[model samples]
Target: VKPTTPRGQLPLLKIDGKQYTQSLAMQRYAAKKAGFYPTDDIDALVCDECCDTLEEFLLKFPFAAKDEEEKKAKRAEFVKGPMTEISKFIEQKIQDAGGKGFVASGPSVADIMLMVNVKSVESGFMDYINTDFYTNYPGITAVTTAMKEHPKVKAYYDSLN
Candidate 1:
């Protein structure tokens, strides 16, 4: 059953009976279908870049440390260093584009990606991490709030709850 996917990943998207691999690729396809993709070429590029950047950062942090002590230290360092830098850059990007709601016009795929990634840090899924993960990044929190208030986005999350 897993042989069809190029990378054998669980998040394979099946649309119209066709299978698609890679979370980012599926996200882009879904965003296009949902009219979340930006109309301008540069805007779309920025959206894609933001999503890819988050994915890369997530990949860099390995939660499976040798022990609890190491785990806590690693997570703390991640939040203080790379994570902070990335969040600041994203915040500035949103600000430079106008602090309405996203890295591009209104709420695009980039906004969704940003919200999801930021929420993961704040959600405390990792026992070692805490709410402090996102307290310093108001811009990211703003995006999360906007996405949460969006009609469809809210509905989807509500269904999960």
Candidate 2:
């Protein structure tokens, strides 16, 4: 699978016999096609900003720590510092966008990205990180709740159970 991908990565998109790499690029394309990408310039910028910030936060995970204790300490430090900071930034962004449960006028790729991030952190898959870490950030919670409540999204999640 790795060899078949353009960048030897998992996220490879094939369309019309053309292969595409880069998860974000593929996400943006899919979002646009699905009408989940904002059409307005400013809204698009906000969506991009939110997605980029979320990706940045994900990239900060210390996956290369030399030992379990070191990894735990690094993760703990990250949760206490950068993670909190990024969460606050996302919370503020959501609030600044009128607290509409989205960073733009309607559902966008940013909302989806935010939902994914929230779910990931709360999934208990990461050691030394509390699943309730996002509870304090109402804005983040609101967006995730809103996304989950969407009829289509709700149905999809329900099907998984």
Candidate 3:
């Protein structure tokens, strides 16, 4: 199944018989279709900036190592360095946007990306990172909290249970 995708990735979106790869691109397309993308140019730029920054952060994760211990060490280093810096950058972006837990005036794809990143970190799926790591960043955590409480988001999670 993976080999059949354009990029051999899990998130392959097929629209009207056209195959599309790249998770972020698919997310943006979905956002636009669902009205979660900003119409205003500046707001849309902010959303793109936030999403790109989040993507960069994810890419910095230490996924390749010669051994388990080395992997853990590298992950710890990432958590202490790049992870902290990126989180701070995002926190400031949220603050600049009126501390609303969103890069734009309202919830956009950027906010959704932010929420997902926060959940991933806080889920303890990444070793050596405390589940409460995001707790220190109120602005970042606020986005996750708001997203989780959103009616549609809440209902979707409820249905999963």
Candidate 4:
């Protein structure tokens, strides 16, 4: 096999001999299979809220800063304030969604997606995850812990080492 930068094409997923390109499509399929998507109307709304926040953060903070002082300043200014507030907003949504649990009746694509970035921060990729970022949110912490222990997720993370 020829090697190339990560900019090269990603491997394809073929199902029933049909290929899917877009990641969202694949994620939706996985969500359906995983049964994490909401079954009720209101819960579905809540799920979208969770997904939206997770997606927003990825776009906002693409990676940890290599500039340590700058990262700390950014964390203190933007992250602890706006970013922390966003997390609380998501938590509030989850709390508002009644006893549905985890913004949905069960774990969905949103869970896995949020888990990816949260785990990155929790696993030492960021300096602030442990320092009050998720301090008040037990649900988020539990979710991240579960994601960290997930068999497949653990394997994928392990393979990176």
State the C-alpha lDDT per candidate. Answer: 0.77, 0.86, 0.84, 0.66
- The lDDT leader among the candidates is 2
**Per-model TM-score on C-alpha atoms:** 0.88, 0.89, 0.89, 0.69
The digit string of per-residue lDDT tens for model 3 on 84-142 reads 99899999989999777555568888887888887887887776678899888888888
Evaluation by TM-score, superior candidate among 1 and 2: 2
Could you arrange the candidates by TM-score from highest to lowest?
2, 3, 1, 4
- Distance from true position, residue 139, model 3, in Å? 0.6
Candidate 1 clashes between residue pairs 3 or more apart in a chain or in different chains: none
Score residue 113 of candidate 2 by CA lDDT. 86
lDDT value, residue 82 of candidate 1: 76
For model 1, the run of ten residues with the poorest summed lDDT: 97-106
TM for candidate 2 is: 0.89
| Candidate 2 Cα errors over 4 Å, as ranges | 1-10, 159-161
**Candidate 4 global CA lDDT score:** 0.66
The residue pairs that clash in candidate 4, if any, are 36-107
Model 2, 1-161: lDDT tens per residue?
Answer: 99887778878899999999898999999999987888989899999998999999989876668999998999999999889999999999989988765555798888888888888778877767899999998888988998878776788789999
Cα RMSD for candidates in order = 1.9, 1.8, 1.9, 4.5
Candidate 1 CA-lDDT value: 0.77
